[model samples]
Target chain A: MKTKTAPVAVDVARPRPGPLALLAGARRGRRKLGRRVVPYVFSLPFLTLFAAFFFLPFAYAISQSVFKQQRSGLGLGPPTTIFVGLDNYAKALRDPQFWDGIKRVLLFGAVQIPVMMLVALALALLMDSAVIRFRRFFRLAFFIPYAVPGVIAGIMWGFFYSPSFSPIRQLATTTGLPAPDFLGPGLVLWSIANIATWEFTGYNMVIFFSALQAIPQEIYEAGRLDGLNEVGIALRLKLPMILPALVLGLLFSLIGTLQLFNEPLILTRLSGSITSHYTPNIYAYNVAFVDTDYYYGGAIAVILGLVTFAFSFGFLRLTRRQSGV
Target chain B: MRNWRHRASLCLALFLGVASVLSACSGGGASSGGVVQLTFWSFNQQITEQADLFNKSHPNIHVTALKQPSGPNQYYPKVLTAVKAGNAPDVALIEYQYIPTMVSNAALVDVSKYGANGVKDQFVDSAWAQVTQGRAVYGYPQDTGPMGFFYNSATFKKAGITHPPATWDEFAQDAVKIHALGPNYYITAFPPQSTGWFQGLMWQAGATWFSVDTAANAWKVSVNDATSKKVASYWQALVDKGLVSTVADFSNDWNAALNKGTIASWISAVWGQGVITGSAADTKGQWTAAPIPQWTAGAKTSAMWGGSAISVIAGTKHPQEANEFAQWYLTNSGSLSIGVKEIGWFPSNKTAQQSSDVNAPQAFYGNQVVDTVFEQAEIPTTWTWPPNLTAVNQFMGDDVNAAVANKTPIVDALDKLQGQIVQDMKSNGINVAGG
Candidate 1:
């Protein structure tokens, strides 16, 4: 029961140009070639960078993870790199310190990620409201922390946490109140988390705030028509609209928390609790450089990469499934 | 589609072109007029000045010395990576504890062929022993930190201590007396981060943390053996009694404590006087030096903490010239005098140690001849620094510092570290003998 469709009138009444079809064909050929080449030229810079820095390193690390550097006798000669298959992976898995680092970072994320997201969302919502004053100033002030380098921020917080250098500690002791040791074994993790939260909360707020800004005014009108107040409109309309931003923020924070190094590294000078294996990234670093065993470090790095990929992929798929259903 | 192929080909060509241009900018040093150029990398500016002097003296061989980052945490990785990449300097200053690791990696050249053994008689036995392994000489010892005891005379006077503690028992008793002066004061600080200092203490107690078996081609680790555990327990008792503060060495708090008379004394190497002088500005004339307290009543045994040697890197084009520079840097009176003046280097060269410049009273130690204290020290020659010492130190810093912070037995930490060190060496394909 297929019906025959008529040809377009323009195709039926097409006229030949004065230059004829041969010249037109040549011109079209050049145009097609140009169209094919132009995009590649535009993308050459970024594509080169991606291939060199990111893709090449990922490939090299994976390759190195399969090999072990071995030395014989007194180890006073050149080392030989030999194939060990999955032995490196097995070794990393069996390492108690490596697992301890992962467990510690996970514990840190469980407490830090949720608290950070809520604070960001609340701040973004507060800034979005009509009653908010000094909007530009507030945004800049909040974002300034993100602009500060992580090492510098960690050092600043380290000084603040130190019993000797901190004015707050001195003041507390003078006022007859014992200043709780912020770098103590029990509180060191939370202290690091506070530094991380202070650094990234503003960045997440910007993401959520931008998403809030993107929502049309008509959505608010629709909520108003449903007899909803401003708070209800924000809760019912704006909040759900920025779910993608929230998920993105959570994903980035999780990844960052797992790779914690600079903060704990700077704080290590102040606290005895932060070990060489305080975080997985730091442990991998100590293994590679401090311990000079790049094979094991490479294996640890690959394992961490796989775990992060699994988590991120699973999260995205789960969110999509829920939204679709 | 064929045009698409052309596009990809063009893109790849462009990438290669750009990469070549970027890499070209990293061209190495080139010499002119028959001069052989050598690059020298070290953490101290004094080394560079010494190199400059060498360049002036040697007309045919030119050297460009670079001042790298300080501390083991920052400097070691840079040189190690440079060695791997074959971009390493012709010469590098390596610490005695770290040289074994470098030798294991083949980053250092064997200077034995360059007649490094001929001048062995010029160096102290302890310094000479560190740079030589089974007759293969790696480098020349620039300096050695013979351990000593430094105290605040004012603080000692206030604590009613007549003289410096001459034995471990007396040190402990004096620590108690100093702590009794006030709640704010302690005899000294047992820095949590300075595992090298602890290792130095163990060495003084006659603990051979490492011993080599050439017949079996294996390393025997005794980090937590009887001698070491004895030293650890002694320090642990002091920590438990709150007779010593556990502040990090050279930290702002430690400096403040030293300045404010809270921490009264420091048990450190000869170079520690430099650290104290650099940090504690207000306590200039109040400081004095003494020999490290003995475990047995009359033991003169001492140990090293932070000192370095000059090694010719494996990839150097001018090995002979590089070795010559290293030798001169270590043994030359001119270079040694400059080091003594500029960076407070305690010469490992026997003749240089007797030079007027070295024997001259250091104003920082209240114009006292502090070398007498350090020179009298007799460092043991049998103790070997293992190739895995760097990792061992990190483990000590972590486990030992944890124990120190948690108010637990420090000997347990040492035992844990001993196991970890052996395991680390074995995993690295080094021969570790016995469990």
Candidate 2:
């Protein structure tokens, strides 16, 4: 039978490969399609939406930033809207208030981000600790402030900041402590930072806790075997593992710090301390609505957007380089 | 087959979601049982009360009132945006200062179409001027906020001052006397919250914010001119003298100060009667009304401040009902009485102003004749606000506040303001000359 099997395999080539070969090729094609086309098909919707909403508007804003409306004479008789290349950007660059806003935001970022991040990280670690009791209740309690809308939060904080109606001021007076003017130039930024932290610390804490949870139990077990304590594991393993989330939180906080408006605006209304051009967003808003310069406002918005993008990208790159990732 | 079924279900879910979202975004109001639901927005108390009264009388119509967040600076932009989005209210309450913007934007209906039949002609001439634009009557005069002075009688007594001053010099002298009594206290209120108030002062001094060339339709900056400079410099001196508190206007501090007798007098309009008398309940009978201090000798009788008008949106479905309600509410004797008594709003109608309710002494102010006092201060041919007065007010107010805060010098600030305001007016496509 062995000798007969060798003789049967002797005919290796026919005039053409028969229906079996074609069938095999068709099967391979189906497999290839399932592997490649299916994934692309699944991803199409998300890509489409991103392109439509985010990318399109961003492109439009960048384009609009380069142009300005220059009106001649009385500016009453059908004023011409001409393209003055880079003039809008130049004007924005030269504006001292705009630069001052940037400097203020930078200083705000320097103080606010680290303090808020550290607080959020501590909260997350505490929440994630196995020793912690009533974890669900604690989790919700910490996150309650995040559930409030920004405008509503601003309004509530505004009342707190108001010297006349504030319970804090009342308490201070009763305790014989000087009621620190939250809206004053010296304290306005911190007051606003407090509001920001109140708003987003819980949200960021939840993010960090989620990232902590995602770390493998095996890694912790390995750490235990290596004689690392809980604190040691958190510092060396857990924190590092969650670095991406921390970085993301920092980026988000930085962006929010730049667009500081509602808190200052509401505070200004509630108190008398915040000025009209207190923040860049407020400056842009006053320019558009109060000053009726939608064009200039548009330019300011574009500049803010670019600055945010640059910051986020630069931050990510720096973190990547530092981590050697 | 199972995979196909799952895919089909997914597609169906997506389709339904999209349909629902699209329908929600594009949905128009459906008339419920032959009743037309009309949305009405108002910032003024008197105008809103009128709308509510009209709604009660008309069964076929339903009017919903949406109160805007405070400040004319916030109101008009929201209204404009809503109008552009085709979601505007049928009836809107607009301040007189914003009427020009509305008219220029073509957002207002020509109320003149209804003719003079039911419309009252007794509104003050300046009030009527604010409502009318070109050949079209944009709105009915809802309330007349004729300028006046409200003084804390206790503070006046403390300063040993008798009779409210009639001229700027006398007012300054009174302020000096009041300042002698306290460090931060002043004889009058200067609002950092409002640039229009400053403009009103300038106009009282016979100065304009801008000069218009009618033919060219361009507005030139007059903010740095002699008249405006003089007014700004005077205010600066007041700030320097430490008579005027660095505390800006319309703030809790300012309001609280008023209650605490920190501000001796507020140069306000008739509507301010409500704020002073209502909020500071303990200070009742301690307040009295007088004419706003004139800028100098030979200034006009008075100027308008913080007044509102009632306008119908251009694309409203029920024009007749809207107009009828507007007219009946603003001009009717009963509605006007409610405004004065409940809300402390001044009646815009000439006949309504003559009502016993309007002429009655308010109990809060120790029987001070606020109605009669403000009535005498109504000046017909005075300052006219540009359509973009809101813009101008904001810029000027900001600069004034900046100067007060020592962020910039008064002259430099005014110069910057002049430059910025002109640039802004042009960008907004406002006839710079006329503005």
Candidate 3:
């Protein structure tokens, strides 16, 4: 196994210097010109699109968030946009609903990210096991739900949650047992998490499975020679090898949990189980659009974006510090 | 190597040049045939179909109708962005409640100019009132959605009731009786998810959520007023007795219950008939419509549920054609009848209200003249719309839901709602501190 790992290490080291050596041989002035000109040529199309959609509107949203709209006496006249620095942010921060949503998502993320990651990891390992049959079929079957659009998935699950339309409910009735109230206030969060897990577990499994495949067979053979079984190999060998992938999955799940919107929004009509402020994204969406308070919505969005950025960057830093990467 | 670099640079330059040229050509397509393609947006599919019908009748007019998805959260930002871009649709189907917001943004075209000869008078007086911003007519009325009681006959029979209840007290009594028949059965399904409907109930009970008559559309905390509390208490008792499902916004449970006859009746919009009948094929003859039992003898003549109207854009290139199309869609008897037959939308045109199709009995509602029943119950139009009607609806929905969820007491929820709505308005620069 150690001998097998040597070739990959050599390959990584050998690829780096060729590009640097080319630059070293160039004339000083030409090197400067090439470095400046090459990246711009490579980035021109991306920069154009970024300017057209993201940067321009991002700037506008930031500008819009700093201002507030006011109407004069009688509220009879048209509202005038007034420039107010940080007031929108202050109002959003002070809002109990907004803070509650933020706190709820954080707790949701803490539970959901680990649960999803662990399930995905377990499934990926099970599929990779030597005794597993029809691996490709099982992998595809698991991945099928990811292909269904979120809105459609929400609607489909909504039927299952409904007593009137649910086949599950009918089956339960035939058995002389009560159907589970999926939309009950007590269990709606977990029900939503169940959906997110069903939709994404396969996608995450594919990620972990790919990471598992990259592990050479020789390492497993060595573990076998040391009398390590498949379970031992997974615990001692496979798990550590897939740490980066696990971290990647965890980060994605965290972000997804924070930005949860589509399922809850679509499922609103299925049961009175969800409110407009159920999730932070939904809260921002409601404030911005339904409430017509774009300034506050923008503030909430900015806050959420910052939270996502902080969590992502903070995780990357923590992983790097721990792994010594 | 040098030649390769030069060729690569040329390729890059050529790629950028072609991209810019194509983008310019696409921008040019925005204006074509010496005509500007004015975009019109609406929430209702029926309204979009009606617009399409009007466009067909009048040639040389190209109005693109964009439907606002059923949920307002997904719809309003698109309208806001389009307006902010200085390229909003030349005409839009603005629901009556949304006129104030559109007017506030200075995004609407004043249709009052086209109505120089009292053309605005052609619509139901209250329908016209929704579009008016201090004497300037902003849009033409398209439909009116007066509230009514739509009951499932099968469920009623099961409860041993021969007629739909005629008063709130009787309604509750019947609801309790229905619940007694089956453990999970409910008398009626309402959007316990929304406070807007709660406010409508308060209105029926002779109280208003806000002081709409005041210069400032400020919260008067009237939801806790005696009559309003009575309305809330009745519903609360129903919920306590398990006579009403503790469902949030119209969820699958609500729809399934309605279709399964687990819910005996529904207090819904004049337009809800379209959704209910359209979604359930087997329940056609099983349903019927009656006047929504009044809270008191004359507390309210009626309370509206849903309605929308069309407006021409102020800066549109084809104002004349737009005006012609708007007038035809809103007031023309032929065009309005098409809206009813094709899409089941009730027309707001006073003349069309008497049309054979408008007055015709619906077979689905046990062959009752459901349309005529809706017209007769038309509320006196005392309630007015705010620019932030969507927010008002949302807040109303949330606070009421909190009460229903037992997360807060009714008075506490109302107080919370009052504070939040007022604070929200103030943060948005609307003065709600005083009337």
Candidate 4:
């Protein structure tokens, strides 16, 4: 937390000013070097951490990806790490399990994100309308699910999805209705999506709401002068105005969905439907940690990294193009 | 587009954040004043009782046992993290199934140097072979899982069954009789997700899933052989006819089903007695243990479902102390008696195994000496647990589970995963026979 602010505070609080301070005096010029160096000194801790935690590990993973551990002669001893030169990447490229995991999350994202964003957009718009009572209470209530961490939310919903333990199932059965098996093979992916939607829609709604709040009242006034009704003005003017916010929300959802891990993982023990490689993140986690196949796992991570980048870039471009019209 | 660096940074941070956290383990164990402070990571929390006794008796070495929960995820990674830190717990309780993987990772120190060979005659031959790869001994054989047929006698009587099934032929007949008792009744729930349980069945049928060809320097995988196929088809017939319930074991539904007497029987190992009694507490005196039903009428063979060994980790600062503790605790009668009470560990140590503490009649089990019943079935100590058992088990479970739900043949599941398992081993640089 301190790392974020430290860099900015360090940069601004330097004794020497910018080039503009050179005009003051020679004494000031002499002190300028110390002032300029002060920012780097303060940011050094964060930068060092960034290098160690991010850059070095990134480099290490990259190094590991091109190499794999090899064994021979009953494979009893410690395996020798060998340079295979993209062999792991090539193997992962053809791995049905890895691709299946990727496809699963993509489908999860495709259905979950749009529906979730729609609900978020509706909630954001309703709040911005100022026609609703207990606005603060509704906002707080919606955001509460997001405050429950993903793992806890997953475990909580896992209980709800379980047929034997669920109150919903009990009520349904008592009413002489056949209870739906939420963790069944056909329904589990969507069940996980429901958990994600519940946890994240509120957080994304807050984002959309804040962006809507940033809009000027003059735009709506202008719409009113054009003989537009409240609904008409809100739909045509306010919606287009929050295009950037919508794109941001979509981007976050896309990223979140692709990295789907927690809910499915928690549900795994309860559900026979979810496989070991249920999602790319979970697959990578299991391969590296459980299976101890670090090279392949690292390759999967980097491939996922590339895929995430391409999706974000493409989504940003598409939204930008649409906004231009 | 403009802040690409920032976005990429955030994404990478999110993805790699968890993996990098593994490097943050700080290990604590020190030898001061000639007293070895040893840490033992055990999933069986009750083992701490033995650790307390070990500390008290062995004045030179104080063992600190940390309770680690067992699962596919929880137990392994914590030990791996400490292995990475190079100051791992001196001793850790790892299941026999996982030992090969740990050995391949070089995460465990071979105790052969710590007079392990001298005490070789003290353990079950198969268990000793399991802990050793060639001449190198990796751990001390602690508890073993020779299975038994645990049945609800009341349910059997209600179904008009006179006695427990002594053979697979009779087991099937009993299944039908039980099914006739009620629409919901079943002979036993086939744990769809349990590869260990299934493998135990295969083991019972004398089906060799894995074996090492020392001369060829490769593992011979015989998963879908005729022997195993016969076993699979026999079980599949039961599943297809709705005689056996297909429930995920350790699940809420299975627990409820067992409690309600809808699920009437189990063919599980020694520790499963605890699971049965713990889940179906109301039916305390209704249950009893028998020898695992044989393919042949009087065959005394059984398959193991669950068991673990006490292994000294590779990077321990006190290997001597660790190995000392592992050897003493596993072979010692004191530890066995303590384990018999605190944990339901069926001893691999032959001497302590015959002790009264282990063979006593359990009240919850209808005054049955459940231990002696399971001891009659001979467990194959020579069954090779492949280094890639986690993947093997995962793929097996995946195939078998899908097949059970889809009404597909169970042997097809074995044939389906055979290639995957072999390929997995080969990719890991293991020499697979005919791969």
Native-to-model Cα distance after best TM-score fit, residue A323 in candidate 3, in Å = 4.5
Ranking by lDDT: 1, 4, 2, 3
Predicted candidate 4 versus true structure: per-residue lDDT over B82-159, tens digit per residue: 686576788998888888878877899988888899988998887787688668888888888888888899999999
Give the per-residue lDDT of model 4 (tens digit) for A1-325. Answer: 2444343223343467666444444455556888999788656656767887788887888888887888775666788899999988998889898999999999988899999999999999999896989999999999999999999998899879876688888899889998998988888899999999999999989998998899999989999999999798779988888888888889989998888888998888777778878899888877877677788889998898889889988888888864442
Better of 1 and 4 by DockQ: 1
Number of the candidate with higher lDDT, 1 or 3: 1
| Per-prediction TM-score to the true structure, in the order listed | 0.92, 0.81, 0.86, 0.89
- Please identify model 1 stretches exceeding 4 Å from their true place: A1-24, A321-325, B1-26, B29-35
Could you give me the TM-score of model 1 versus the true structure? 0.92
Worst 10 residues of 1 chain A by lDDT: A8-17
Candidates 2 and 4 compared by DockQ, better number:
4
Compared with the true structure, the alpha-carbon lDDT of candidate 4 equals 0.84
Which residue runs does candidate 4 get wrong by more than 4 Å?
Answer: A1-27, A34-49, A321-325, B1-27, B30-35, B77-81, B84-87, B180-184, B380-382
Clashes of each: 0, 4, 11, 2
User: Which tens-of-lDDT digit does each residue in A1-325 have in candidate 3?
Assistant: 2343343222333345676554544544575798899888677777876776678767777878997778754354667778889988887788778878778778877777788888999999998898889999999999999999998899888878775677887899889998877777776777788888889999999999999999999999999999998899999999999888888888788889888988888777655557788888999888777666678788888888888889888888989843445
- Model 2 docking category: acceptable
TM-score of 4: 0.89
Q: Interface Cα RMSD for candidate 1? A: 3.2
Ten residues in sequence with the least summed lDDT for candidate 3 chain A:
A1-10
Considering only the true interface residues, what is the Cα RMSD of candidate 2 after superposition? 4.6
Tens digits of per-residue lDDT for model 3, B402-421: 56665455666666766766
Chain B, model 1, TM-score against the native? Answer: 0.90
B94, model 3: CA deviation in Å? 2.0
